[model samples]
Target: MTTPESALPMVVPATDLPARVRIHEVGARDGLQNEKTAVPTSVKAEFVHRLADAGLTTIEATSFVHPKWVPQLADAEDLFPQLADLRGIALPVLVPNQRGLDRALALGARRVAVFASATESFAKANLNRSLDESLAVFDPVVRQAKDADVHVRGYVSMCFGDPWEGAVPFHQVVRVCKALRDMGCDELSLGDTIGVATPGHVLELLSLLNEEGVPTNVIGVHFHDTYGQALANTYAALEHGVTTVDASAGGLGGCPYAKSATGNLATEDLVWMLQGLGIETGVDLGKLTATSVWMAEQLGRPSPSRTVRALSHQE
Candidate 1:
């Protein structure tokens, strides 16, 4: 059987490189949100500190979504206060709507991410609104965030493929991204929510984004590992001048829409690759893996990260 890496297109180093590539650790928020068991607030705070210690400049602290929607993150108010105690850390929270943003702002969140989808089905299922309607709903939130001087990131989900609607149109993804940009979003993250993207598709869409005059610096990639293609996809995006990438520790995330799919790219695996390529992630691979393993033990299950598995066995 051919592996995912085998199927990936050959990587050609880009002639021009960006000043730096920033990897935002979303393990504490996105990673843990989908977990079956609720991780304790202390564990979540410690995990955030650990990720910061491992040299992650930006860490998604938590979401302010309703506890009824995500009981796992019921301690958002408590969690937000803890971020104040940790210095030199840029923490962003996931805000689903104006209410969510209000909660985050009240808690002193400096940055917020609003999520929308390129596919209609995903938008409806994920947020109970149509794609266009969701964008319309986000209009006020974006305006308010800008007025509040809070940095806002717009997440375009199913940019590659949607479980409900396979092979999302590139034009659709571009349309949403452009709308978000026009709405004053500081950055946009093209998300592979189901991990079904290939290197060819990524290059094609990236080329489209470039043609549309979307600045590469403000664009990021959030790839899932459902088909084990996250790393290859990351390398492809990096070659295309994508400067920011979102990943989770221990491969700990999943889409509620895609039942059989895996989570985001593992931070441990991503850092390992970057380090091997002489890239500076400023993250300690060993310590990162140790933190992942500890979380795995707490969850009473082994992490899905390949790097963590390999490194943990040596201990």
Candidate 2:
């Protein structure tokens, strides 16, 4: 490959002090959403506690969406009350609409996430609304969350490619991200929901955001391992100043759009990378690995993490 000097940045002094990045552990929600057998709420709570114990400051406990949409997390209401007494863990739950938000607020949720799709088709399939309409639906939710002093996180799915609409434009992504930020979302996770993103694409998208003056600190990346490039893309995002990355422990998530993806970037794999780069994730890799292994056993499957595989027989 002929290297274009302009395509890649010139080598600069590497920062020995690793950038402080927050890893929002999504293994409990995204990881369990697609499974046929619903994981018990006790198991879910245990996983959340384990993740919290591993020094993950933020953990997505579950989704408050309708059980019809995601049967696996139907116990969100049941789970929340049990976890309500626990303190020191920032448990953010996914709320798909006002009803979901209401359910969460009733359980005293302090932080909630509303997800929107960048592509119209995905929005329609996922939320039964057009992109614009979906964005509108979340406006009031964001307002209410803000008024109640609850942090709101917005997710823009399919930032890379869509099953119905291929090759999402960078402009569309920027527009969606801007809209979410404007709606008072404290943070926005630019999701490669169906994956299909490359390092170059990630850098290009971040450059656009930087150009638009969107605060990079409030931006996060959620990548699926569709083409086996999620970690590489994540490193590219790190280099471009993205400090928050979403990963599932044990690589336990797959896209609803099955043909386009498998599991997400494994948390263990991501932590290993961050550790290697001298970044402070605050997550204990050994604990994460052990928890992931236990979770995989409960789910009756092998962990998708390569690091887990290499370390398994050693124990």
* lDDT of the candidates, in the order given: 0.86, 0.85
Per residue, candidate 2 scores C-alpha lDDT tens digits across 251-281 of 8887564456788889988887777677878
| TM-score list, all predictions | 0.93, 0.93
* Cα-lDDT of candidate 1: 0.86
TM-score between candidate 2 and the true structure: 0.93
**What local lDDT does model 2 show for residue 20?**
79
Q: Give candidate 1 misplaced runs (Cα > 4 Å).
A: 1-19
Clashes in candidate 1: how many? 0
Error of 1 at 39 (Å): 1.3
